[model samples]
Target: MIDNNFKNEKAPRNLGLYIHIPFCRTKCLYCDFCSFVSRDEQQREAYVGALLREIEARGTKDYSVDTVYFGGGTPSLLSAEQIGRILGEIKESFNVSPDAEITLECNPMTVSDGDKYFKELRALGVNRLSLGVQSAVDGELKLIGRRHSFEDAKATFLAARGAGFENISVDLMLGIPSQTLDSLRASANQVIKLAADHISIYSLQLEEGTPLYRMRERYSLADDDTAADMYELVVKMMKDAGYRHYEISNFARGGRESKHNCKYWRLDEYLGLGLAAHSDFGGKRLENTRDMERYLGGEWLEAASDISNSEREFEFLMLGFRTADGISKSEFLARFGVGFDEKYGEKMEKFKKMGYFCEKGDALALTESGFEVSNAILTEILDFDY
Candidate 1:
């Protein structure tokens, strides 16, 4: 039965692809990304072969993919042959545009192997490299269980440049147990020195099972006040370095925003392939099993759900609030076939009255303070069933 509920809504699809590589050299303390700590080449080769098979088995990709991301266990850990094979699979499976922004997640230690890694990655058509250089200080790196040193990260950047990578993004974290303002700045400064095109400045999140979370039982981390200070410091430093804070945790130089992640922020559809991967396509949300065993045998899809109209609306408001440029008013109206002012008039009016939302032409954008308590503000706008 077709529901009339969202008959007024606009549905847009500019598709993207996410390929997951669930293998890692070591797991970090505050990390929870799906990756296994193993050097089993046999397992890796087998996984690559299976992934190729999966790619081959996929339904026809009718849309031209503008962005394709190879996220990790440590994609850099893969042999050149392995990386090439996967890219070949991608080429064979879908119509990836020639100028597509193909991004690969790499580790500092991985590229220390030199031209072999970078040359192969470039040859395979990856244009962007997101390097995980969590911290520059050795102490902070140790505390966070990161394998690369400040020096190693520099070496990795040098290697990438030597290998002819022009578009590179560096990942750094804030609010670690031993992290300080000076330490954090040093990390950022070193990364900026590399002249990376983009940077992902993430806060240290203590998940339930991670080592950092367990450390909470023994040592005190930076307090909320200090963490906030660290985040603000990062914002300032990155901005001063000529990077735009396009998204909360991301910054890019010039036009170097991450196309892959922007797809997520824009609420566009994507299909993820690998253990513990998630996919949102055709109004359906699906997640693959986190189990490697299940992935090997083809019993991998763990869950699927068609999102409710209410849920989609909630997502729209929540995600729109995350970007520097808040949701487009005309686009919002077009999507819902009604004035955004009509749907969330109370909240919009309330916020504008309170000076939280500023009228920006046809869009309603969050003021600095509005962005501060964005969750509370968005909650007021959404008609959540829960």
Candidate 2:
């Protein structure tokens, strides 16, 4: 069952740059990401200036950047000129590859005049757009405190197309309050019809302190079992619609997978810039201070943690399991100086017998059922000490 093609080694020395824009029109009820209400034009301009200074001070020209992602509170909240200025700084400060995949995440409400925004973004070298289209059902969206209507989402997608964004991704939400299997399927179908190159279907999570968590007692949301059913149905439907399930929550058309995100799952190095952004580069994990005022004052405070070999191996296995590609046995041995089966052969046999895993070539991947309980399996199987 061994495959000779899969080798264990770090990929070529390249960089993936992630720029966080912590400004948005409004914070969604479920968002826990570091983004605040849209600031005044003066405040916004000052923030962009600070970001540019940070990029210049910290960005290195040594590594060739192959991917750049502008993620947000709502990156689209920034005018195209502002976004373009940041891109210019990155390009000047780093050895950005010519064909780099530059993506910007946008909320539908911010893109009512998408044609104008999209064209400017394209001119700024951003080739991909990731639209936040949480739900196709209007009622569900309103309950979630989303500002855009379903029709608005459709219009924004069309606008992106008309403005020349051939590589676009759409986000969908499942298991939200009052979200049924039918509604989830309808949303998935709508996105599929949009022919977005990539699709990300995330299950609504009830994190404490969010508005949804406070309102949980009032709304009867889908139970775990119902959510599981919705997950299965969407998986089958997305496959039928010709999208490959590349990652747990992400799907893409052929060759359209997110290159920047793949680096994260593969345990490759990436650098994140901006307030509260995290980075794993040069063998340490670093997190920027979340305080915007402190950041603006030129105090780029950060927390740094060095990763040991054991921690790296643990991450390699855990992250790889989240993708269609299961970890390679030979690669594990090469990297860790221990064979996969030699260390965990019995555990592998046990899970295989339990039908949670399937052996293909040198890789042992989770069955569809296994993905539902991956946390439990990983906890039991991976020895953090080793």
Candidate 3:
């Protein structure tokens, strides 16, 4: 039996639901997502129970959720019945819109079950699948410790299509230890050939705690010069394939951007449930503890994801500037109730002179070169005496 929780509510928000599935088959060397290697039936069932109760507890808010995202250790690991039940819970709890974009992140290794599980997931309301297909080259995939092969990824993509997922996204990685520009290009070209609806290309981030980080002490990663060249190749290839480089790392065909992710990039409020999930209910950012004992037994006060307005402003700038569309002055004003130009005028004056910032109507967007130096640009925005 699950205990009912007192829901926290705030002013109307650009609300979204982020359900974390914290289990994986084998943790990738580069993986740092909050996941544990487990296949315990009891634990899986327990998590679903807690998640359902939490969903029920938050049912009081009369807000619209434009998206629901299942991210994690590999959300595809869960049985379709578990996922379906939670969707039922969400529908029973909140005023979820009929046309909301619901997404599930899946790893290629799991889709070969031949059980027609994805169809069941679609029946339960998951309309999009973000497939983890980091590389097509066997050496790079082996270096990164992915469980699935390139062949498996292709089969999974076909399976997802067979299962009725029209809006599919593939995750691609560059700068792996065993990768060269040509090798990585082969992966990107393969993804394009698959005709995936969306592509998210991420430069490998070597975090200190992962196995890949330890291996990095010995392995020479593809050089920064090479990585830049790889990115350039990807831009050309993906554009030729008819995908729009909407954000720094994301590309989509037509208008198939990840609506759930937009909620995050646009600094909209979201509720994150499950161990190590993060949330920003209006301006107060929170993160659930990574420890299962603390998260499950104690009052789940996830670490703070957002705090003061100063932090919020800096974060907003950091997130908003990552997109080619950039942050809109009007949207910023609508959220903060202050004109962006009024707040960031002199600051923009400098960046404008630097060929980084440009004006489109009342909005400020970044140029292609500006994206390469976006972090430093964020520093310039943050240095403002706000």
TM-score of each: 0.92, 0.94, 0.91
lDDT, candidate 3, 223-338, per-residue tens: 86788888888988998889998898899997999998987787777888887888877557788778776655645665664476556666677888888778777656655567
User: Which residue pairs of candidate 3 clash?
Assistant: 285-305, 285-306, 286-305, 287-302, 287-303, 288-302
Q: Candidate 3, 174: how far from true, in Å?
A: 1.1
Q: In model 1, how large is the Cα lDDT of residue 286?
A: 89
lDDT of model 2 at residue 55?
A: 95
Give the Å error, residue 147, model 1: 1.2
Q: Which residue runs does candidate 1 get wrong by more than 4 Å?
A: 1-13, 353-355, 383-386
Name the top TM-score candidate: 2
User: After aligning candidate 1 to the native by TM-score, how far in Å is the CA of 93 from where it should be?
Assistant: 1.5
The candidate, 1 or 2, that scores higher on lDDT is 2
* Lowest summed lDDT window (length 10), candidate 2: 1-10
Model 2, range 182-287, lDDT digits (tens) per residue? Answer: 8898989898998989999898988888888888899888887898898899889988999988888889997799999998988777899988989988888989
Please, what's the RMSD in Å of model 2? Answer: 3.4
